[model samples]
Target: MTDDQTLADTTPPAAHESPAGGVFGDPTAAPLQPPTVRRQWSIADILAEARVPERYARVCLRADLEADHERILTELRTLIDVEGNIIEAEDASLGEETNTARAHRLNDELEQIKADMAKATWWPRFRGMTSDEFAVFNKEHYPKKDGASLEDYNNQLVAATMHEPQVTPDEVAALRKKLGMKAMSNLIVKATEVNTQGGVDVPKSPSSLQNLTRQ
Candidate 1:
């Protein structure tokens, strides 16, 4: 017999005697439903369960780091929008002194924002380790993909979030067309010499928030 079957054969039945009428102690009780079968595991199964703490911590750390990574990407997108707005304003200025002065001020503000972004402590202390420490952590916590190390994954994420535009290429083409038409309209308005009214300041540039890593 198999180990489980041999063990089951030698095991004793429930020690307690059934009550007078039934196990439920009711004389009129219908036959009790068979007890639900519970799962049984051997020594190997118990040993496997012991690894929960280590695995749980690793999973939690990965999830937390991923959350922070997303937050940093969001802040980066805001910075890009601000920069794009400055570009649009400069483009529409058409060499006007007031517009040029405004553009300079915006540029200065953008620089300050960039500095602050660089200074932001987006990751936790554990995640902010030295390069060697990070390598060790990645080796332990993250599995390699297609022969690339953890550092390769990290670099890919950085490049995608920081350097790539958020929108699809098709969407970017459409946005360019829209911007071109808007610019032409601005030029027409300028040529007409009509008194212009200030409009709401909204960031309508192509989004810089695409998850390029998936690509």
Candidate 2:
């Protein structure tokens, strides 16, 4: 009958909702729990999980080849100096042959030595192993010493995991012989760095817009 009474009768009840829960109901009712959040995987994330980081080590099997390379380089530098003097002095001859001719001969020799050295160098690729894989590898290849400390165990783990998948045991033995203990240790360090530290160098950005577009 009264306007105020009529309005009150038609009006809906006020919601006794929790601000945090955003749930509407009786004040005495429990608040609704939030829905669980889940991680969404992108293509990049999936690929990253599946991808294995790789590293390469270059080892020369012939110390003699390295020596020859250095010797030829020295000879080439000396020949170049003499060649410059010959041109300045206008001398056509040096011993049995002209400096220009001898310089060319030395250049040929240097090139050949470089080729030989390149042939002797081996590029071995290594991939990082998963923790489970590394554990098994360590047990098989480099077992922990008795009463080993944590540091020693970790060191052995690293040493065991530096594996060149392409090379055979005989090839590895040959490499060790050529590299010696010091160089072999250094190579292992490099492999470990790549595996643990993501040692692939980030390529430099293009210097100009043209280069970027070309790429």
Summarize candidate 2's per-residue lDDT along 9-40 as a digit string, tens digits: 22224644455423322345464554598678
Q: Please give the lDDT score for candidate 2.
A: 0.54
Which regions in candidate 1 have their CA more than 4 angstroms from the true location? 1-97, 121-215
Once model 1 is optimally superposed onto the true structure by TM-score, how far is the C-alpha of residue 31 displaced, in angstroms? 90
Q: Residue 117 error for model 1, in Å?
A: 1.1
Number of the top lDDT candidate: 2
TM-scores for all predictions: 0.17, 0.52
Q: Which pairs clash in model 1?
A: 166-209, 166-210
